[model samples]
Target: MAFGFTKIKSSPIAVDFGSDSIKVLQIVPTNPPQLIAAASVPIPDHARTDTISRMAFVSEALKNLLDTQPFKGKRAILSIPAFQTIVQHMAIPGNAQDNIEFEIGLNLQQRLNINPNRMIIRHFPCINVVKNGSTQQEIICIAAMKDIIMQYLELAAKCKLDVVGMHSEPVCMLKAFEQLQCPQDTSTAQCYIDIGSATTKVVIAHGSEMVFTKAIHAAGEQFNRQLSVKKKVAYCEARQARIAHAHGIDLEASLNNVLAQSQGGSSHVNDISAQAVIPMAKNEKTLGRREGDKDSIEQETIECLIDEVQMCLRHYHSLFPDKQVQKLIFLGGESNHTNVCQQIAQGVRIAAQLGDPFARLARIGLKNPPIGVDLDQPQPGWAVPMGLCMSEANI
Candidate 1:
């Protein structure tokens, strides 16, 4: 094929290998990024724990998705799942500033008892700290084993895809909300709480700079287990029930009944009854629990999650006493439950809203949008993949 003066550019495919599912996305690089194609495949229950099985499942899913979707180019960026990476805050001698990377590597080697050369390390310098009157530099360090990186690369190669960059979930998540950063007001801190399948990630940032991050053990899977135990049902059944509750099928049915009454010209039916399905204000102190067997179980599970998030916020406030998180932006698969999010916001005493990565996207003209994904509604689970699209190649 001959002859173009201008080089054609396409964003690298963003692959988010989540614990519960594998999400693949690509966007046209433009002023307001345009959605090109997206697809998601759930990880089978049998493959969830075993590494070999999981990898094999991912390989097959990725191959099918790429071959079927309208994704352009083969280059892709991957997000290392939160559970697979080591993220920590360390204090090093101020004198080590000149060779921070080397010092961090040595420190990690000593702490983890692993070969520094066998790990890929990255760090972000934070505010200095004084311990016993001696000044020290504080930094957030992220590391992943070389073997795990190679495994991902090999998977991509097998699928005939080129792996261009690798990023941690926290980094990719922050990148997804770049448009929300307020350059003029750098002091206003914001918190992002991503409730994923295995773990929850809490990221605190002041404007565009990330200051702190933590991964909580409590998340969606825990919720499912709690529901399973409470209901005396199989884990898979509980998971299905949880999904149905999140989608508000019961509420939808009630709304449909109200609409039917209004269409029959009943004077008793009012607009307020129809709008009652919307979640209450963030400041509400309690959720109006439904009266039934499922009510107590759902409430207890949400309370447990809120407790973990509250603890994380307290820890962050202790470290950065001067900076307070002004807002909470909830993302990830579990955030689809509006009632759960509202209760957590109430428990944390912070104004919060569900994060929508596609909110700022230009007129979406997706050719093959993933099943069950509605562009008109906020898709919080797509945050990591969308952020990857906005990311630059680390290589």
Candidate 2:
């Protein structure tokens, strides 16, 4: 008999097919997970509006990334973009527990006028309620088209990736913060706001159980349009300027001055302190053009988003009258803008902080980190991909 050691199981690659970009991540599941490989590619300007073109672009990008990166194993888990899935809270007959799927299918067919057999449906039981003098269970139903799931699977196959599991973005986002849950304190509710390029997702959790989720259409693309119109610049130019401003490049001179003072042992230098010292430029030239315009255009755009977020909170409050969200943790690509996050926090009137999904992870193989990822700063944008990494595989 030949004796051999069993091979240790490696984590499946976590892929997030975001509207703006496609992010791939793999981690070694150590005590504190360690980053093994990470890569991202932005969707082209021409492909953003076309579904087929976007999928083709993503397929080629994934193939190239996997070929170059040191990703282990061909097995992968991916997130279904929130926009592609239908999430709704519905009340069904109390006796439907044994046939919940059938009831949900019938309800969906009646309300949405779509064939439920063509969709992959899942539900989470919320609470029981008396409706029409009959007890009914309120459940959050998530449905994604079977064709869409097949498309994602086909995309993965094109990249030679074995799709092991798939999940919705909201679920993946919550998984990314699993380590932060306080089992001892179940009364305090928390809200996670993921402001992505296409949409902003609001997820509320009481203790470790998620209770509410909403997706807002107001997000980064709106900010870009606002900036483009206000600055009289091309859409692409406005996008670059918006990114530069978010990274504090527009206030370079002011930040340098603060840095000098900090080095002189004046005070601690952080994002908040730097913002305080550097009066946000009203209008300044950076990256060879005027990039600072947060006072008007940016403020208006963010205010629109804040209003939507407030509405989501109000809806959650109406559902759980006794529970109130005590904290707000901002995530997603657009959350990189501290000014925007600060405004939203102030507008929502909640104690808030930028969520760093990678905070507890030990970064490795980061000599050349992926694009849009700066390990030194809080990466609220990588929340979905990171969360996907922490999730369990189907097989």
Candidate 3:
């Protein structure tokens, strides 16, 4: 009998630099991966203008987050921002395996005007294709500008952290789903809809391999803007209202101050107008229409989101005619909306549900989770960072 069995462990952190915030996660590399520390902080507006300033701002944020928690190590894997990267599908001669690198470089120059030398290009094998009456291999190519990668490295160095590996946001997202559900049949396809603050990344994958991907430039923030315009409320207030509506809560009653402010009255109501006071005192329903109006605005916003998602599905089908997306898995911040998830499922006529990465990890025995973290709840926004943590040796 082997008398010595010691549990192997590695502490690796994952930092996701998103458009709105920086999310940091430290995980102990175990079978299920234990959460050592986690923090999310907003990215200041001024820091977003340029790369140098943004890198400095991110470093500051990273220092603050790490300072607030007890993360094990300084080594980290960074999630390359989607805005700074691009994914392309290239068709090349199927038999050109001898000079595949040259073929890939030529295709990049021809299609995207991207010099392979200036960018880090990685390819994932996709299904073979028949185009122009000739057989070709379709490969998904991910490229991130060298400068962008350096920016992240610089940030890590400034934060006194070691950069171990880097991955695109979409690939990290797919990796999270792979741990969540393992498709028994390779032909069964699943689509991941990661609705973030500014963009919605739609990724179609069979098993752990990504087959198709698209980013809807308009997503959660777009809905917030529409709510602000239609509901005549401040952007912050509209964001809250949109989130409540997504949870299937009627926010009309709670939005009294916002409605009052919209009508040229102080939200605090020190000196109430006769019209405003009369409604509450006399039970007039005039202000109640605003409630109905809010509902209508929500419906319109959700419909637009559904339409965009449907178009993405159609595009995926157009390219891969034989593959059908059997399930829809929602992720990112906006996917927390139950109504949004239900509506998209109904609109697309597919089985839809939210992806809970935490719960998936828990099944593998995530130890010492943050004191109050509810593994049952679906946190769509944590997909990327969590997946990044899973990139370590044993997670």
Candidate 4:
């Protein structure tokens, strides 16, 4: 067994288990990577919070997707949810004549209050520091709860899938973006912000190697909820409004179009709701601007998001000042929102752009992608699964 960390020989499917949805992908390693197949499915409401419920839902969903989709592979590399993993940076004495595992176990036990015997610990070695003429290796530690690991294993077995290896979400995203596009100057650093439905993942990487990774509770859900509260509307309606606002869709124009259709005795009015027809409410507070502006809703919401990103950036720089981030890259479904992208760039004071993991890959149109997939444009959320497949395919 590879213990879910070692690479396997078979063509491994990349499965990203997220809080709201599951993304699956498989690719063939080529100069320009070939997309084998891809799928995304929403998580059921009953399985949102309970572990066993989630596992059961996911197992069933995986089996159904594989059976129906064009994906080919039995082995898989999974993305460990950021919330389930404990990540930290530590320095261990180098040039020592001692077993490294023993040192790591002792450090974790003393520092993190974690029992090494009950956790599967993995470390990625980073640049070494010279302290008092002694070599000290700086490494990033990732530890997962043993029971959670077992749940994933069981889920894989239930689907009759071989679990080849597992990696953290931040790592997978970094790998996928690096393969797609990265600064040619290895010395320069870049930041990756993956804004999922319920959580946001921040990663600072030098080239393909990550120096820092963190998970924040603020994400698309928070923004939507804020919009709902501020606008005094239902959540589903608020969600539609926020998405439309972010995409710069003129609500008034859309409403006019609908009215024109309705006047022609079309059934468009029946299909459109009052919430979607109305424009976003103004008079909401904004960041770095006067109150009651039309864009205030978006600006104010993104202010909270920017605060979290700044915290992560401060922490990253505190540890590695020399590796200052040169640019910001946004991933995930929320990254498609133009307003979010612009606000993040202005808030971070760094040039920002959306990441395309399929930038260098073969153009596989969105004619028949897996259910819940949006191939009309670049899907930055697929970065995790794509990166996992790249790792398995060794591309």
Candidate 5:
């Protein structure tokens, strides 16, 4: 029998696979870890419509991306979609890591309602755990379904990238945050939000450990769609207009015309408010009718968003009612959507004690030019990719 199996140090490359785009990042720690290389690849809607086609395009893009970077490492760390994986901390025996993985698989399989054998499990000894309604020393076992896990590895294989260790999106994101802003004081729970085109993820962390995470069903892309359809302009144009609107610019006047042109019961485009369109923003009809039906549309959007946020907070509260979330941070393109943060802050204020948590990185559109755009800092939507890369290596 082979004894003392050789331990292979996992040199995982982090590739962020998203609905609209994909990006790869690599970094090595040795006298201030420097960024090896970064690349952004876009996927068209047609290609993404089918799984097989999408995979093909991604495989091709990955090969090209790797060629450009010429990274020398084989082990790649990848970010799994938060919703697809189950993240929970259970008190398992502080025994061998392998044994704990086996037993934890049994418990989580029952808890997660999945076949026990189908899970890809990993755990690290936690300094403590909750027992008999009290906290005690134990291990933190993170389990993700194997089917989903293998898909990622397969994708890496297809791209000719090495897959070392799999990472939960939230935890990886927390590490990215620490990299961006060296954990201030290291004593408070910091909330991080990542808003993609369709899904938004909120993660709470202390140092590199993620204590809570949640995702919302809305993002900047949807808002752009609302603007694009109504305005008849391209999505890029609408996106620009929407960002301007987020910063409190009154695009209401011309935006009305865009609504007028698009206002047809035939399009099946639901226009909640004449306000969604500004007559001044578009010379032609760019927005739908919001003239008199303000109440229904306004209330519906705000309430839905509020309900979603509260649901996430309630979940975390159930775990530790007394644990106060210090700062609520926001991320993603939509985080810059005007008063979105204020709206979320107000919602949390009513239900729980949400400290002054801001998103990990908030993007402010159009800074001093010549500088081009300062997306490197928090004021821009720079944290997402950085977090995706920085998080892979963090403990």
Candidate 6:
């Protein structure tokens, strides 16, 4: 009952709603986290835009999850898309708790400039403050449209699931880290960057305490867009090109071929359809660039990714400039790159590393069930659901 609802007596599972898919992972804490059951299903591209349709799809998948998996739990924890919401900690003058509430109300009204009536505004006390020769408590504020939140609850209801609590994407992911018993201390800093098809989220924390969170508009699909235009290939074909590039299966010729197709020149004619082989039309696609150069396109894309990482580093440094980042985690499928972590390390002057929270789920007593769905290993895209479950279960 964390979201102003009746408290659930039993621990619920975790349900993560992603842009392209929905994942549910149930963790029953043992010595390490024990995974009771886990299931993942992709939302069709066409159905993703409709909230109602997405809900129906989620419900259908959850039913299948329950029928096929051994996870037996009724309570559920939920996570919201961090990118769609604004989350930041702002400090103001210190005052008594009641007066502070009033002051915070005014401050949010002024700073957020959003209608409180239309938005779901929740504030968590951050750190106690000393300002204007008085004691003031700082709060981390997260605001999202009420409509979006209601839609989720409504969907959950339709699915016959009871949601126990709601958590932010970063928090749930971090909870998954904790379930993993990631080396976290006051001196230890970790940054989790989830790069998806449409956007990338950067969240940094010292140990388990969150320090910074930000979102950039560039993601994996953007990379595919470039390949499509450069190779003049269909979306699926361009996607194949990108995956091949990421896996190191192809090289300059691979890219050169894509570019050749874009220019309407030569055709490889490798038993592929004319329409499928046709080079894509080019559109002005912008990305995070380390240095501005149009010709060095590959480098440009890599640098743009680094630039976003640099921004995350800057935010982390502003809070703890003296400390160094001990670990860097890439969470989304697009983050699968050989030199991406190293490149980020070079750009930010810190050791960058990839992290897998899914592996840690077992350590926290969650069961990793095989439900016949393909799980993209390497990346723990399942972190959110595991996190929500952790939040609901309190471990």
TM-score of 3: 0.80
Worst 10 residues of 3 by lDDT: 272-281
Query: How do these models rank on lDDT, best leading?
Result: 1, 2, 4, 3, 6, 5
Candidate 3 per-residue lDDT, tens place, 1-395, comes to: 67876966555788899886788877665657666676777656566557677777888878877776777677888898877777777777988867778888898888888888989877877777787888888777888889888878877888888888898888899877565456565677888888888777888888887877767776777777777787687776776565544434455643665566557877442321221011111222321123344366556756776787898788678767888998888888787555555666677888766676665343333334442233444467888998888774321
User: Per-residue error at 129 for model 5, in Å?
Assistant: 8.0
lDDT of 1 by residue, 309-390 (tens): 7877886777688888888888998887666777788788887777878777765566665654666566788889999998
TM-score to native of every candidate shown: 0.85, 0.84, 0.80, 0.78, 0.63, 0.74
lDDT of 4: 0.71
* Model 5 Cα lDDT, one tens digit per residue, 1-395: 76996643323556777666676655443224444555666566657558778778878887887766645576676777554556565666434444665667776767767676777666654355465776543444556778877777888887776665566656656665464454545455556656666577766666666666656676656666766676577665565555545444445533543345445423122322223112122322322223342442233454666677777667656555666676665555465442455455556763212111113323233222212122232232434445555544432
> What is the number of backbone collisions in each predicted candidate, taken in the order shown?
0, 0, 1, 1, 50, 25
Report the error of model 2 at residue 339, Å.
Answer: 1.7
RMSD of each: 6.5, 7.5, 8.7, 8.1, 10.7, 9.6
Tell how far residue 2 is off in model 1, in angstroms.
16
Which candidate, 1 or 4, would have the higher TM-score against the true structure? 1
lDDT of 6: 0.62
Candidate 1 global lDDT = 0.78
Q: Which lDDT value does model 3 have at 118? A: 89
Candidate 2's residue-wise lDDT over 76-177, tens digit each? 999999878888778899988999999999999999997999999878777787878999887888889999999999899888888989988888888888
